[model samples]
Target: MTNQQDNIAALLQDMKSSVSEFEQTEDMGILQRIDADFQRFAQLVTLFLIAERDTYYGYFLMSMAFRTNYAVSTIAGIRLGEYPPVFETNPLILLKYSLKEILYIFCHEIDHVVFNHPAEMMKSNPEGNPELFELFNYAADASVNDMLNAEIKHGKKFMQAPKGVVTSKVIRNKFRLSHVQPLESYQYYFDLIKHHANMLGEPQQNGIAPIPSGSAENNASPNNNAIPGGVATSNAITAAGAAGNINDHAWTFATEHDEPASESAEAMAEAVKELLNEVDSMMDGEARGLMPARFSTAVARANKPPALNWKAILKKYVGTIAADKVKTRMRLNRRQPQRFDLSGTRESKTLKIVVAIDTSGSVSDKEIEQIFSEIFAIIARRSFELTVIECDEEIQRVYQLKSPKDLPNRVEGRGGTSFTPVIEYINKRRYFRDALLIYFTDGYGEASIPRPLTYRNLWVVLGNTSNLSVENPYGLALPLEE
Candidate 1:
C-alpha cells in the first residue's frame, strides 16, 4: 500500500478502537448503530483526503478532536477555543450528501474558524440579539462559501458546495445589492444587510424579526434523546433542517439558560493567534503556499495589534501621578545602608480618575457599551478610584464607582453634548483636583471649552479625532476605535 493509504488505514483503525472502547464503557443501546455511522464518516474523510490531498491537511491536523455525534444540531460544526478544538458532526445528516458535498461542508466549518467569524460575530452582536446574530451567521456563511467557490474555480474541484448553501451571490440577489463584491469582510456583509433592512423599514428598527423561542432560527441546545433506532430527536432535526442556511453559530454566543463554551472576543483572538502559529509550525513551505492567501490575510488582520494602545497610554498618564510616601523602619535606606537611624520609605499606590461620559443623542448604545467595557477592563486590573460623571449639555449624574458591579444599569442624559460642564464640575471639586479627567465623547459639542488647570485632561473621542483635536486647544486627544 502507498504511504498515504497506510496512514489513512491507521487513522481509521485508531478511530474504530476509540469508538469500541467508548461502546464498552457506555450503556447506550444504540452504540452499534453509532459505530456504523462513524465508520461511514471515516470512509468519507478518507475519500476527501485522497481527493484533495494537498489543500486541507493542515486544517485536519489542527482539528484533532473530530467526533461523530448524532445529536449535533447541524450536519457538521466546529466549536473552537478549546485545545485542538472540537469538530462534531451528525453523521446521519452527512450521509445524505455526496462525498464531494460532504468535503465542502467539512471545509466550510473550518473556514468559519479560520476566518475568525464566531468571535467577530460575537463582538458585533454583544447584546446576543438572536436576529442580529442570524444576520451575522448568514453573512459569515456567504463569505466562506464565496471564498471556497472561488478556490474551486481555480481548479481544485474535488468538492462542490451543495445547492441552497448561503453564498455571496445568494445574499446579493436576496437583498437586491448588485454592487457588493464577490468576497467582502463579514462586517461588510453584515452592515450592508442591516442598512438594506433599515431602508426597507423592516421590523425591529435594526431589521430582521426577533427569533421566537424553540424556533429553528433560535440556536438552543438540541435534544440529545435518540429514537429507538438512533434517529435524531426533535430539536436536532429542527437544527438539521436549517443546515443549508445556518451552520451552528451557537458557538458565537450564549443561549438562554446555558453557559457559553466560546471565549470572549479578546480571548478568542488570542486562541486564533495560537492556532495560526501551530498551523504555520506544522505546515512546510509547499503546503503553506498551497493554502489560500485570504486565510493568511484574515489571520493577520484578526491578530493585528490595535492601532492605539489604550492600556499603555493610560499607564503612561496614570503612572505619572505622585503618591504619598511614609518612612518605615522595616529596612535601611537605599541612599545609605550604614545609617541605621534612617528608614525605608513606602509609597502608597492609589489612582484617582474622573471619567466623563458624553451620553448625548448622537452616541449609540453599542458605542456606550464599548466605552464602559473598556473602562471596566482598565480599572479591573488596578487599584483605583473611579468617579463617573454622565453629561450631555450639563452634568446629569455623578457616580463614585468602588467596583465594576457598582456601575448603574442605566445613566441619565441623551440630550445635546457639551464638555464645559464636566470640566467645570471637576475643576470646582477639591477632591477631584488630583484626579485625571477623561472625557469620552463623540467630538460633537462646543468649538472649545475652558481647559482644566487642576488636573490632566485626556479626551477620548469616538469615531473621528479631528473634531476633538481641532476644538480642544489643550490636553491630549485620543481616538477611540468603534
Candidate 2:
C-alpha cells in the first residue's frame, strides 16, 4: 500500500511538472488559467458528489469560446451522450478581459458541467414562445450565479486536479462579479438555481443579500468579501485535514437543505428568466429592459424565426473578430471584403474545387436539400467537376458529379460526424490540382482538418458554425445564411 501510494504521488508530481513545462512552452497563459479553473471545478464537484448531489455534473460540459455569433459573455452547445468535458478559449477575449473574468468564465462552464444541464437552454421552449426562451435564459443565469456564490461561501477557488488546492484567486477576486450588480446575467443564473432549488423545497440562505444587476445601491453587503484583506472563512483551513473533511461537511450541508424534486418543470423555468433579467440589467440595461420587452411587446419585429443572415451578422462580427482570424483568411483562397488596401497588385489565380459534406441526423431534411441546390447552382455556373463526398464519421459516399442530378437519394450512415477521411482523401487524391474544398456541414465534424494547401479550404458552414472551433490559423470559415 505504501509503495502504491508513493507511485501515485510520483505520478501526480510528474503530471504537475509536465503541465508547468507546457505552460512555459506555450506563451499563451490561457491554458494555465484553464488548468486552475478546472481544478476548482473538480473540487466543487467532489463536494457535491460527497453530498450525493451529482446533478450538477452538467457544468463541466459547458464551454466558453471567444468567437461567437453573439458578444454575450458565454455561449454553450450540447451533444447527446456522456463524453469527457472540454474548455475552449477565445484568444481575443483573453486579450480583452481580466484574468479574473477568464476564471469566472471557466467557473461558468464548470457550473454547466457540475449541473449536467444539457444544452437545452439554447433550444426553443416546448411552447415555442420566445418569451419562454427568454425566461429560461433568466433561470439559467440565476442558477449559475447561485452556484458561484455558493462556491465562494465555501471558500473554493481554482486548484489542481484530483486534490483541488487553492492556487489562485479567492472568492473575493473581484472582476465584474464584485462591482457588477448582484443577480446580473450570470449571477442571476446562479440565483435562479438557488431559487429553483428553493421552489423544490431547498434551503435559501438569507443575509447574503441580493442586489439589482446594475444598481450600485447598497454596496455595503456584510457577506461581500474583499480578498487578501477581506472576510476570512471561519472554517477555512490550509491543511489536508480540511480538504479531506469537505465531503463530510457536504453531506451535512445536504441534510440541512431541502430535498430536491425529481423534476420541477415550469417553476424551474420561471426562475430562469427572472435571473436573466437580473444579469442583463447589469450589462446592458437597454437590451434587457428595452430590447427583450420590445421583442415581446407588440408583434415580433424580427419574427422571421431566429434565422441567420450570416452575410450580415458575419460582416458585423468580422470587425470584432481578432486580427489573427483575419490574417487566417489571408492565408486561405476565400476572400472577405478587405478593410484596407495592399500597396502591391497581385494577379488572380485559378483553383480546383472539392466539396465535402456532413450528412448527419441533426441536419434538417429541408436544410440538406437547400444546401444541395446551392452547391449544384454554384457548380453548374462554374467550369469544374465537383468532387463531392458524403460522410457522418467516415467517407460514406463519393461522387464525381458531372451534373447536379447525380446527387444520391441519401448519403448513408446516420452515426457521428467525422471530417478526417474526406480531408485525407482531398489532400492525398491528387486528381484535382489546386482544388478549393468547400465543406457543407451542420458544423458537427468530429476530427478536425489540418490547414489545407494554399487557401484551398472553405468551410461553407451550413448551420451554426459557432458550435465548432476550427483551430487552424489558416482555415477559411464562412457560415451560410440559415
Candidate 3:
C-alpha cells in the first residue's frame, strides 16, 4: 500500500482502539440519514454562519467525531480533530433531534470552536474538576445560545432559540449584569454555577436540586480555580460513561482522545487568519449584519484583551509603585543562585490598591469576569493589599485580598448604577489615601465628578461605548471595547 493509505489505515486503527468502549454499530439507516440531514443543515447554517461571522471560517474544516460508541450518550458533541484535521461526532444521536434543533446544535458547536472554548477553559484550569468542566460547557452553551437567540429575534430567519437549559440573558438579568462579550459571559455563568454547586453540591453528585441564586463573590473555593454550575437537567441523564469526562471541555475530548496530530493552538490561529482572508471577498452587508459588532467584539476578546491590554495599562499606572534599593546578605542565603548578584537587593513595597467594580444592573457577568481576571492577574504577579468594593447604586460587599487565593468568588450588586458611593468612600476616609483607585465600569451611570476629587482615578469602561459620556478630566478614562 502507498504511504498515504498506510497512514490512513493506522489512524483508523488508533481511533477504533481508543473508542473501543462499545460495539461498532451496523445501523446503515441511521448513518444514511445523518449524512442526508447534515448536507441540508450545512447549507442552511452556511448562510447563518456567513451572516454571523466572517472570521468563523473554522466551521467548514470540522469532521465527524461520532464513533459508534455508546459512551458518547446521545449528547451531540463536536471533537476537534488533529490527524486529519476534522470534527468528530456521534451522528446517530443527532438524528433524533428536529432539523431546527440540529441546526442550532451544529451552529452552537461551531461557536464553541470559533470561540476557542476548550483552549480557553484549559488555560483557565488545566486540571479543572471534571464535573465542574461539564458545567462550564453548559455556561458556554448558554452564552452562545443567548447570542444566537438575540440574532434570531433581530431577524435571522434560518436560526431559532435553543430548546433548553439556562441562558446567559437570564443569568445576566437575574444578577443585574451588563452586556459583556461571550467569553466573559461564559466565565460569569461558570462562576454562578460554581456558587450553585457549592450551595447544593454538584447537581450530578446529588442527582438533582434546584440551584439557588445568591449575590456576592464570597463563595469562591480556596484554590480560586472553581467554575460554577453543571447541567443536571433530565437531558443530561445518560448511560454510564456516555457524557464523557470533565476535561471534555469542548469538542476536544480529554480522557477519550483529543485530535491526534491535530493543529496546535498557534497553528489553528494562523489557519483562522487564512480562512478569514479566503472569505473576505464573499462578505456582504447581510452577512455582516448577522455578525453583530457585539459578537465580533466577543470573539476578539477570547484571544487577548483587545485594542487595550489591561495588563499594560495596569503597568503604566501602578507598575512602579514600590521599590527600595538595599544591600543583600548573599553569604547567609544558600538557596540564592550563584550566578546572581545576591549581595545587591531591592525591597518591594506593598501597594495598597483599591479596585472598585461597578456591579450595577447593567454590568454583565462576563464583564465582571473580565475585570476580575485582570485584577487577579495583577494579584498573581505579586502581593498587593487589594481593597475590592463591589457597588451598584451603593456598595454591596467589600473584600480585603492579601493574596490571590483570598480573591472572592463572585461580584454582588444589581441595583441602579452610580460611581458616587465608591468615590465618596475613597475620599471621605483617610484610610484610602495614597491608594490607587481603579474603577471598573460601563461608563453609563451618573458619573458626575465628585466635587474636589480627592484621589487619582482610572475609569475603565466595558462594552461598545468607546468613551465615558461624562468627562473626567482629573483622571484617565480608559474605554474597553467589548
Candidate 4:
C-alpha cells in the first residue's frame, strides 16, 4: 500500500478507538447506517488507489464527536503517478445516488492540498476571525446549492455529472484575496472544510463547524488537551461541574449532555468526589468574605477619599433634590409614603426604567461609553432602580441595575437585530408598577408588542431620523435625532 493509504488506515483506526468508548446501546440504527456509509467510503478509496498507484496523497479519518459521525481528510502531496491519472473501468462510486456531490466534496478537499488553499487562506486572515470564515462558508454553500438546484431543474441525476470537473471559481468570486491580509489566508480553506462537513450529515461539536488549519499554526487543536465531553477526563465536563467546581470552568459539553444520566452513579462516583473537593476550595473564598469584622479594611480604604469639589457634589445633590421635589409635587397629597421611605430617598416609587441598549456591529465603543454614561446619569439623578436588558437577535443578558455603577460594568453582546426579547422581558417582569421601560437602541430592530405585562414600556432609539420609521408595538419608539 502507498504511504497515503497507510496514514488513512491509521487515522481510521484511531477514530474507531475513540468512538468505541461511547455506550452505543440506544443508537443501534444510527450505528448501522454509519457502518454502511463507511463501507461506501472504503470502496471509493479502492478506486483511487487503482487509478493512481504511486501518487503522494495523505488521508486521515476524523470522528465527528457531536454528530456521532465519521469523515475523511485527503491531502495531495508529490505526484507519484503520471499526470491526468487514468481511471479504472469499474470504479466504485462511494455515494451511488449522489456521485456528483461526492466528487465535488472530494475535489474540494483535494484542492486544499493542490492549491495550498489552507496556507493561502491563513496568511490572508487572522486566527479565529469569524467574518473571513463566514464569507468562505457562504460562498462554498452557495456554489453547492447552485449545483443542487441545477440538477433538480434539469431532471438530471446528480451522480451522472462527470468527474474532474471541480473548479476554484466559487472561491475566487466569493472572496477578494488581493484585498485580504496574509493572516487571513487560512480562513478560506477552513471555511471550505467546515461547510463541507455541514453538507455531509456529520456536523462538528459546536454548532459552528471548524475550519482545518493549513499549517501547524492553523491546526484546530483544542485549546486545552481534552477528551470528548462524554468521556470523563481529570474532571467532570458540564455547566453544573463548572458551578460546583470553579476549576472546571473550561469544561464544556453539548447541551443535551449537560445533565448526565448517572451523575451520582457508581461509574461516575469519582467525578463527584473530585467535584466536592473543588467546591470546598471555592467556598473557602466566600467564607473569608463573610467573616465578621471585615469592615476594618473597607474603612481604611474609605478614609482616603479621592479629591472631590463642592461644585461637583452640589451639581449631583441639586439633580437629586430637583427630582425629589418633582416627585413630591406630582403626588403631594394623593399618595402616602411607605415605611421603607428614608429622609434622603429620591423618589416615592423607585423608577423601574428598562434600559434597552443596541448591541449591533454598527455600534462603536465610544458611542457605547457615551450612551452608558447618559443612562448612568439618568439612573443616578432619578434614583431609578434599573433592570437593564440587552438584546440583539435575542435577549443575550438581563442585568439588575440597582445602582448607577452597573451601567459602566455591564456585559456586552453584539449580533443580529430583534426587539422581541425586550418586549418579552418587560412583559415577564410586569410587577413593577410605575415601571418605565426605556430602550436605548438604533431603530433598526423589528416591531414587537409587549405581552399583557403590568409594566409600562418605552423605546429610546439611538440613531438618525432617516431610519426612524421602524415600528415598535410595545411603546412609543422615540428616535434620537442626530
Candidate 5:
C-alpha cells in the first residue's frame, strides 16, 4: 500500500476508539491548553460521530461525524472520520461553556449535515456571497438548536440559541406563518426568510438570502467593505441590526473551522461516503422508521442512492467506457494468425468515450432529455461503452453505461455551478486519455485557462447560456438548438 492508504487506515482505527483513548500527536499544545473535562466532552461527541450504526444505536449512524481540531470556539463537518478523533476546541469555550452547551453545539454540527445547509446555501448562492454564508449559519443554528433530541445533566436542555439568532417563532411573526409546521426543514426556514426579504424590496439578485441570505447584508464584510474596521457599509449595519445581540455571538460555525487539505478532504469524503453507504444498507425497517420523517428521507437517499445505477455511477469515472473503433477493412490479423492476403497490415483498436455533464441547477429535465437524445443519435452508430457523469460546480456522480438502457433515471446535485471539478476529474482518469469527451452543461461556470484538451472535448450547452462568450482553446462549444 502507498503512504496515503496507510495513513487513512491508521486514521480509521483511531476514529473507532474512544476520544480519551485516541492519541494526540500534532495538536499537543492546543490539547494541553484545553481542560480535561472539555476533552471528555470532545470524546463523547467523537464517539457519537463514530458510534456503532446499529438499530438500537442507529440514531447517529447516518450522521457523518468527525473528530477534527475545533481550533476556533466551534466544530462540524466530515473531516472527523479519521483515527484518534480530535474534536475542535479552544481554551475559552472549554472554560466558559457547560457540557450541555457543548452537546448543543455537537447536535448543531450534525444538523448542518442532516439538513445539508452548506449545499443548499451553495445552490442558493453559487457566487459565494459571504453575507449569505453568515446568515445561513445563524439561520441554520436557529432552525437546528430547538429541533435536537439531546438532553444533558439533570434534565436541563442542551440548546440555548442566542438572542441574535432567529427562530421559527421569528418566521411566524415576520411572515405570519401561523401554520408553519413545528419541525420544518432548514430549507423551509431559508425559503421563508428569503420570500419575506424579497417582499420587503431587498435586492433579490440570486433570488435568495442567508438564514435570511447574508451576501446582501450591509455589515457582511467589516474589513474591506467597511471603513477600515467599523461597519461602514449599510449592509454591515443591516446585518448587525438583524442580529439582536449580534456582536456577542459573532463566531460562526462554517468560518470557525479550518480548511482541510483538498486532496485529503476529497479522499476522506469519498471513503466516508462509501462507509455511510454500507451503514445505510442495514438501516431498513424499524431502524429507519424511528427517525423523524423529514430527516429520514435524506439518509434514505444517501444509503439507497436512487437505485439508478450507471453501472453503480462506473461503479467513479471508475468504469471502462467502450467506444466504436474507427475501422477500415484490412488484409491481415497480426496478433493471432496473420491474415495473409497481399493487401495491407491488419490492426484492431478498441475505442472508448468520456461524457461530462453539467448538472447545475439551471439545466432543466427537458435539457437533459433533449441533449442526451441528440448525443445518443451521434454515438448510436457504434458499440461504445458509455460513461455518464452528473456534475454541478463538482462531479456529483459518475458511472459507465453498458448499453443505451444503462442511462440513469436520476441525477445528483443541483448545487451551485462549476466545471473545473469535472476537468480535474478527467485529468485524473488518465486511462481514458484518448476518449471523446462529450460534455453537457448550461455554459454557466468556470473553465480552465489553457484548456486541457488531452482528450477530445465537446461542450453541448443548453438555454441562453449558449449565448455566453466562452473561449475554448481545447475543443468546440456549440449551442444545442432544439
Candidate 6:
C-alpha cells in the first residue's frame, strides 16, 4: 500500500485499540476523559476523510479543523469566516451511529457548506429573528438532503442517510405540498413553508407543530427517531419537535454563545467561495465528473463571471486614440500676444477613424444596426472624419460620414467573408493609412487574416463571441454584446 494509505490504516487500527482500552478501564482522570473524547472525534473525522478521498467533500474535510464541542446541540456543524474553517461536533452524539450513518451525517454537513447555507441564512435573516432563522435552516436542509437522497437512490453514492433527516419528500408530505419541486433553492422551500405557516394562523412564537406519533403522516423509520440537532424529538417538526433546527445554522450568524459572528455576512460568503474554489481546483477531471450534477451546476453558477460592459470598453478604447492637430492663424496664441504681426495660431483637433462593417451572410441586419447605433453615439460625443467601409469578400460600399445624418439608409454586400480584402483596401488608401481601424464582424471568417502594419485596428466582435475566440493578427479584439 502507498504511504498515505498505510498511515490511514495504522490510524484506524490505533483508534480501535484506543476505544477497546478505554472501554476496559473503569476510572480515568478529567483530562484523560477529555483527551479520549477528542481522540475519538478526530478518529471519526479521519474515518470520513478516508471514505471520501479524491472527492470535493474529502478535500473540504481535509482543509477543515474538526473540534469536539459537546456544547453544540447538533451532532456536528461547520464554521466559516476566519482562516482554516472549523467543524465542531458532539463526539458522544456521533458515536451513536454506524460508520455508514456517520459518513452520511458528515456529508450532509458538508452539503450545507457546499450550498453556502450559513451565509445565505445570514443574508435572508438579517433581522436575526429566531423563528425565521429556524425556517431558513429547515429550507436549506430540505434542499440539501433531497439532493443527497436522490443521489443515494441512484446508487451514485454508498452512504446511507440517517433516519428522520429533513428532506423535501418528508417536508412535502407533512405540509401537504404537492407543487413543490425537488432540488430547488432553499429560498423556494422557505417561501412555501412561511406562506403555509401564515395561512395556518399558527403563532410564530409557538413554532410549526410536529407530526404526532400516531398520525398517518408520520412515516419516519422506526429506528430513526432522534433528529441530528437536539432541538426536536424524532417524530416532531417544530423547534420542540422533529423538523426544525436540524443543525447549528446560527453559527454563521452568531457564535455558539449567541454573540454576533466575527466576520460580516459578505466576508463569510467570500471566504466560503474562496474555499470552494480551492477545493474545486484540487479536484481532477475524473473526480469532478463523479460528483453529482447538482454540485456541478452550483459550482458553475457560483463561479460565473460578471457580465462585461461592452459599451464602456468601446468608449474607453476610442477615447485613447491619438488625435491629429491642425494649426491656423484664426485666433491669437497664448504664448506670443505682444506683436499683432506675429501670427498667433488656433489649434483644432480631429479624429480620423475607419469603421469596417462585415456585410457577409453570417452578419445579421440587427447586428449591423447595433454597430451603427454605437458608432453614431460615439461620433456625437466627439469630432471625427468617420469612414464606414462595407465589405464581405471585397469592398462593397465606402461612406465618408461627417455626422450621424450622413450615414446611408441601406448598406450593401452579403458575399463570403474574408478579412484579407478589408486589410488590403485600408492599406492601399493613403488617406486611411494613418486612421484607426475598427472592424465589426461575427468573427466567423478566416483565422489567418493579413496583419495591418500601417495603423492600429480593433475587432469589435458582435454577439456572444469573445476576443479570445476571434482571430486577429494585430490590434485589440473587443467583444460587443448584442
Best of the candidates, lDDT: 1
Model 6, span 1-482: residue lDDT tens: 44544554455455434433433342223224544545555555554564554345677776777665433445667778556887665443444444456566777788887787777887777777766776776688788878777767876354677666666775686568877788887888898886554432332211111222332331221232333343222332221122223335665533345444324565666767777877777677887777666567667756777455556555776677665544556656567876666666543356678888888876576666666677778767677788888998888988788765566766788887777888887777777666778888777777786667545677777665553334545876657763
Alpha-carbon shift of residue 45 in model 2 (angstroms):
66
lDDT of candidate 3 over 1-482, digit per residue (tens): 33433443344333333222212333323333434444444444444444345434323432322232222433444444343333334433333334445455556666665566655555454555665666666577667777667656766544444344346654554345576344346777777665443432333310111111221221221121221222112222233223333222343433344533233443444443343333333456565455546545544544453365455677666775544334676433346656465564656465668888888766676666666667777656665677889998899988786655555666798777877788787778776665678877777776476742434567777764454665653676666652
The deviation in Å at residue 113 for candidate 1 is: 0.5
**Residue-level lDDT for 85 in candidate 4:** 22
Q: What is the C-alpha lDDT profile of model 5 across 1-482, one tens digit per residue?
A: 33433443344334323222312222233333334444444445444433322222223433333332322322223333343212343222222223334445555555555555544555555454545554454456556654653222224342343222345665566456665554566666666565444333232111111222221332231231222221111222122112222212222223245543333333433443454445456566756565455455655554553332222222222233433333344544445345564344433244467777767676676666655565556555555556777888677888887554566665788887777777677777775676767777777665443355444666666655344445653665655553
Residue ranges of candidate 2 with Cα displaced over 4 Å: 1-351
Question: Is candidate 3 or 6 superior in lDDT?
Answer: 6
Q: Write the per-residue lDDT of candidate 1 for residues 166-192, one digit (tens) a residue.
A: 777767877788677778777778888
Ten-residue region with minimum lDDT total, candidate 5 = 203-212
TM-score of candidate 2 versus the correct structure, residues matched by position: 0.29
**After best superposition, candidate 2 residue 285: deviation in angstroms?**
14
Residue 325: error of model 2 in Å? 30
Model 6: how far residue 57 lies from native, Å: 1.5
Give the alpha carbon lDDT tens digit for every residue of 386-438 in model 4.
Answer: 66666777777877765445455534677877767766666665344445555
| 1 or 6, greater by TM-score | 1
Q: Model 2 over residues 294-337: C-alpha lDDT tens digits? A: 22321232222434443334234323322212123234333434
TM-score computed on alpha carbons, candidate 3: 0.42
lDDT of 1: 0.65
For candidate 4, report its TM-score. Answer: 0.27
TM-score for candidate 1, residues paired by index: 0.57
CA lDDT for candidate 4 = 0.38
Number of the predicted model whose TM-score against the real structure is largest: 1
Better of 3 and 4 by TM-score: 3
10 residues in a row with least lDDT, candidate 3? 206-215
Error of 6 at 451 (Å): 36
- Candidates 1 and 3 compared: the better one by TM-score is 1
After superposition, candidate 1 runs with Cα above 4 Å error: 1-58, 195-247, 252-263, 306-432, 438-482
